[model samples]
Target: MTQRLPFLDRLAVPAIAAPMLRVSGIELVSAACRAGVVGAFPTANAESLEAFAGWMARLNDEAAAAREAGTAHAPWCPNLIMRRDPARVRAEVELIVRHRAELVITSVGSPAAVIPALHDGGCLVLADVASVHHAERAIEAGADGLVLLTAGAGGHTGWANPFAFVRAVRAFFDGPLVLAGGLPDGVALRAATVLGCDLGSMGTRFIATEQSLASAPYKKMLAASSLDDVMTTRAFTGLPANFLRPSVVNAGLDPGGTRRDGVGAGGAPALRRRFRGRRDPALGRPVERRALGRRGGRAGHGRAGGARAARGIPRVCIGLGFSLKGASETPDGLRGPRPEARRGVSLAPDFLQ
Candidate 1:
């Protein structure tokens, strides 16, 4: 990649499977690595600290096996939410350092508290940001890189255009950059590179992959969905993010794109106490999204336990212009109005190759 980061050299495709909540797990993460891209999952996805340890052990084992077999694969990174209970966060820090994680992506909060320890353990820290200010803060906090969670990203997204956002950050920071949004194909990945990102961070695209932890019905619904079928609202977490419109409708919530249940000040506690009483036909239960990269059962976004909708998305926002033009299967997926779709994408050039 343009950044000369050694790990980038090992990836066949300059991309990372986002560490989504509930959506990312061992299967999805492992598959992404096998596909020549970084695979990641949120540590908070596990119900408990012990369960988190087991998940990490299994992932490390698989990665080690791949290495021993001389198979080409990328690294498995874990996303950590730093604003949780202090003791719990500290425990997670110990586990991460003990595992000797190669890359740790910190989200929703500052990386400052955990950076020194992670660095001490030889783990490079990449902070997730939705704004230029956050990017600056992350850099000042000694993050090794940045993941720009731009607009159109599902599960709490920023509104800045990817092109503008990357340019804004590149003005001061020249370290590694991973752009995350509505990227769904190689062309979008290439487009991200052209905009100065070293890697494209894709979450929605991996949801439908064969190894995704998403339910079959959810995957099928996503594959059948288009840009319009996706809805953007601040009601879920008080941060604008995209969600499947039909899913919202299925929850008996208004699909008119207005804020009805956003977490107001001190709203998290009350929301967190609410339970997921509604069962979804597509998702089986209420969906648990990466709300502000929150930990534990959260609100409105539908965790089975408590309705703890997180409120820490320091904002940003892509879903458009794509053509799955092998002409093999019906071309129905995330598409924008860009004219580049007709020609199709080729292998990435010098920077990515």
Candidate 2:
């Protein structure tokens, strides 16, 4: 039987660089692809679908050229956050299809709407599901593949054992499975393969690479700390995610304390009631991804959930900002068309490594 996702055979590494907002941009994507792995960026990072179209246009051209020139190349992907918002979600879906994105990583909700669009566009769809039940649902929803997020994963994660997770999913499905969590290096990559995973997912490790959009402090923290220094908090996005010690301290909260001092009185009651309905790990509640580096889920966009430019850390708004000029302010190589200055998000880069 033919597998739904045939792109795996073209990859040089059994790794899919996780789509990190702000951090995983074209520069990092291109770099990872050049390094023989699947590189991805979040569609949410683009200001609009038109911008995403342009971004993908350039990336597709590059990838095509590289392949033509005999350079080892892998497909580039963009993540789409599926939710109740039909308009926004449809726009993103249209962009992915129009751009012919070889892979689409769906997260935060169902893979229902976009899967047909992706299939029509001749693209592979991989849903970011934290549990086996979610994986089954995604598969039933027509996903071509699944990205299994186990415990200790950086973003919204499932608190399941990886071995158990693999076993549970393998029992019913044998399609393309990319295991995500803490696979940081070659050894971890080997282990995942041994566990029957076709591929490994990595996010933290790339946050330290030259191409990453992470600030100096974030990379430093990743290099300085070990797994012991990492902590999970629903405070960041209303979703349980692992974070670094420095970010916790910068947000003015005790890393060990789970209580939030400023939670709203009315909102807390509503949130509690909502959590009651979402007590099951599967179909988890939506975690609000905000910026500004605040602890806990908030709206907008800063450091609350998405990979954001670390506050108290230098912001390299070089390409996306005008009036900024410096070697350190520029992206890794300044190769492609000069991208506008983009905000640098701080992220711990060593969890997988």
Candidate 3:
């Protein structure tokens, strides 16, 4: 049996807006929460601690106002990539505790050291893991939940099949399990629940949403592309992750070629610098420090305009292409009806029957 959190049990939609490094922002998070799903963004999206604090303040204020207005939004989540510089990780953990964010997501490393602090502050921690080994470690580290990032998940995803992954993890731990990868529609979400996952995590689908900070070109590329367009490579981040092949081509790098200087688990340290400091030739400008700190005016790594300009590198890490079909009009060539055709299938416990 799945061990449910009171908060998760109350969600109208058993889904979460997976945190994408360059796509998630306050606008997207707030929108998803308002629409009855858990909305999340990454702490690393902020260029500095001050900016992170400001973004959190804004998010909290907006969420509070929404709740007072009788909106049934789920708690907002901030993903902390645990494998970055130790000092940076500590600082982020401090900020998360200071804000008392109700839900926190940890990825790319063990949560043992950080989980205690979050738990102490009455925050629920969900660790992202690609395999059962990591799943067991996260559970031992006292994470309240696990985000099983199986094959096809965007950004440093695991290679396990969701079926085997969930079943394997369920054998030992039943605590709120979320299945992440290729969850394109209500049917996929429903299937995850039937497979014993507490919620289905969707990233790419949300990228095409109006609220997302993804650039117009990025969104257009997603809509036009298919699974065949997604290539898994460790070149950019030094860890295997899915990226759009076209983005690589646009960046003047061969998607099929090997440029493997950095390759290892937890590529956070090296990738962090590149993601923040490298300007993409495609965006045509350097990242201004002021823009990164701006509160109401696009303040994260993933959003449109300033954010994209700031980290002006070719966009990689777009997740599985299958999920984008619903939001896209372009056919993927190999097809059935687009995901949008199927509707009204609810994963909510009350609506399940």
Candidate 4:
């Protein structure tokens, strides 16, 4: 049987904007909640604990104001990378508990040790899992839900087909299940529900949004990129991750032949420099407008969550090209027409509204 959590039942859109490193922040998270979806950001994204506290305050304040206005805003979630570093994990856990965060997403390690504290504080914990083994372990460790990171998800991802993964997990546990990876539109969101997932989690699609913390060129690059432009490599973080080839090259490394000798030796610094430029801007800024077109959809493009429709589900198009100079394709074997720029398909209006 399917399970329902209080927060999941309150969703206006059965989706959660995945907490992304560097890309997610107050603006993106707040905008998502305002648009009626759960908004989240990683604790690692904060420059320090002080900064994280400030972000938490802002989110709490926004949520209060929304409540006062009688607006149904989805809850704000903060992601904690449960690492072996005991000190770091302890500090982050303390913050989550102190703030009484409603929902939390944990990654990189087990939540077994931390789940009880969070639960006692009325926080729901969702563990990120790439395989069935991890899913079972997470549940055994007391996670309230499971977020299956399937293939094509941005950042560190898994190769499991979402359908098979969800089926396998449901066989054992039926609590709230969230599916992540390549869910760029409402149709994909509907598909997740049909597959028995409580929520569809997405990250890359939001990188193109103006509220994101990514640079202008980075946002443009994501718009111009496709599955072909994505390269899975372990050179950056000692774990497998998907990165845009153009961004790799822009950092002065060979995308085709990049290598790292040790954890702190090579590629890591360059990759960091590429995203976090010499001078980064503050967190608060006005949201910009960027267009993303859907495959086989009409010619109506607007800001994130602002697309229009005629007789069916509104087509929210995100421009699939991000090359500043508009490079048609990458030189690597990964090549294809931009996936987000096509048109002609439609979804039932009922599923969308």
Candidate 5:
């Protein structure tokens, strides 16, 4: 079955700059959108509700100006955190609507709570889901799209292979689907479309770019890294996540273990750098070390912002071949599950006009 996602037609390439926390500010978001791909940032990136509102205002205003000038900008989507504090969530939803947001991404919780209000405001929603349970629940909750964070994804990633994940979801739901997991370049993006996903999501790839708000050191470190440097551990966020091994060492912690006590006596005592990377008890490493996360009142040893793939995606991935194909309101070259079917994800029926 074919699906419709009108926003995708506006993109020069079927890609998205996935939002990274503590990074991905106005400049990066705007840069990505202007480059003809959906750009997004987490609302939590702002210090407070007022700051969040300000970012929304600037983003919306700039986008409108670009469109007025006939620029190649796509829509700016804001990632909203809905995991805690009901009042804060309500307030956040208000701000999103007040600023005339085009699309909102709900993470860490269900989007059901804000769907009606957002729909009333003419805003679309995409839920970031890692499992089939979450995916099904999001659809039942009325999300307009699904950002499939599959295996190889950074921060709190899923273990399912994208092939299996996309196939299962496409069986029932068919909205604007995005496949996220180690998507670093155009070739990967092309693979996503061929695998039945509408968009290929890039988080670490975008973070490495200068346009991103990630720290300079982190960017350089990511640039020098390769797949062997990535370690998937549940130490930091309690969920399976990928991190740079060098980051763990820099914090004076071992990247081997994932216990949640306190660090060794030799560890940073003042700033209390507690990383999820634990030491092996058998290897004579201390076992009482707290892991990095907001839960249990512990913070990551440091802001070990991760980087994956090469840098400067918007600039480098422009003409590497394999651009999306549009024909008679249907996306060509989009296949489902090993090419047994020619089904693809696309905009609504009237999007071609």
Candidate 6:
């Protein structure tokens, strides 16, 4: 049942850059491709189809440049969130097909809008799934591959353990498998391989890379932050996402005060003029923290402008091979934990794409 994906086997690293909302831009995508891995971005980042079209053009041009420069350019992919937004989905899928994307990652539903078009265009389709049932449904809907998002992943993740999840999915489909969420480095990538995944899915790791659009602060935060620094909650977006512990502390809420109760965007803080400005219980104030977000007209922290604003880095590129700074200088050959543990008790917001 091994389904072969053409062009995917050419990667130097057995991993794919996760389609980060603000981090994955043309430069980052092209860089990832040149670095020998699949690069991806989400359609939600583009306000309109016209902008998406322009984005596609830029990405393709940059990728071509990388190809001519003798770099290992891999295929680029766009993530499509198929909800009730049929018209939007249709338009983005058209652009993806028209631009000759090598892969298309669809979430929240089947690959109905773009799967056939991608197939007709000879593109590979990988559906994101938080559960085994979703995986089966995607396969039945004719997906070429599956991204098994386990718990502790940055975004929407399933409750299944990574090892068990991968083993379960392997029992059914032998197609290209990518394990997403919390895959920070080469060590995690190797773990994914041992778990029977063809490609490891990395998102947060790229956020700290020199080629990334993540802000300097975000990159620095990620590099110095340990596995314990991340928290999963659906406070910002209507979905679950991983965020920095400092962010929650800045919001003036006790990270461990609230229990993980009730689903569907209920735990989110109510809209306020200013969020609490410090995680330290002692240093607290209702400070007018310049909030970052698209909905409220406030740019999300580190975003440059508009949705595209979310792509810029907030700090200088501080490459930490491992989660700890100065812990390991070697980026390529490190093997660490499958699940990086955090000792602190805190909660964080989740980014939805």
Candidate that scores best on TM-score: 5
Q: Give the TM-score of candidate 4.
A: 0.73
- Write the residue-wise lDDT of candidate 2 on 1-353 in tens digits: 32545766678878888887657877888888877899888776666777888888888888889889988788889988664367878888887888888888887678788888889999888888877668888899998888887766664444567788987888888888888776656777788878878888887767766778767666665555554445444333334455554554443333343333222332222333333322222113222122112233321111221222356432221001000011112132221111111122222211110
Specify the poorest-scoring 10-residue window by lDDT in model 1. Answer: 344-353
Show the colliding residue pairs in model 5: 4-347, 5-346, 5-347, 257-278, 261-289, 261-290, 262-288, 262-289, 262-290, 292-300
Cα distance off (Å), candidate 1, residue 276:
14
lDDT of 4: 0.64
Across residues 49-155, which tens digit of lDDT does each residue of candidate 6 receive?
Answer: 88788877887887788678766678878888765358767877777889988888887566766778889987889988877877888888898999987766653
Query: What are the runs in model 6 whose C-alpha is more than 4 Å off?
Result: 66-71, 235-238, 256-353
- lDDT to native, each model: 0.62, 0.60, 0.63, 0.64, 0.62, 0.59
lDDT of 3 by residue, 26-128 (tens): 7888788777798888876666899888877877787788779976768778988765577877888788778878988887668887888888889999998
* Count of backbone clashes, every candidate in sequence: 18, 21, 3, 19, 10, 22
Mark the regions of model 3 whose C-alpha exceeds 4 Å error after superposition: 256-280, 283-318, 321-353
**Candidates 4 and 6, the one with greater lDDT:** 4
Instruction: Give the runs in model 4 whose Cα sits over 4 Å from its true position.
Output: 257-353
lDDT of 2 at 176: 84
Candidate 1: list runs displaced more than 4 Å.
1-3, 257-353
Using all chains and alpha carbons, the TM-scores for the candidates as numbered come to: 0.73, 0.72, 0.73, 0.73, 0.75, 0.71
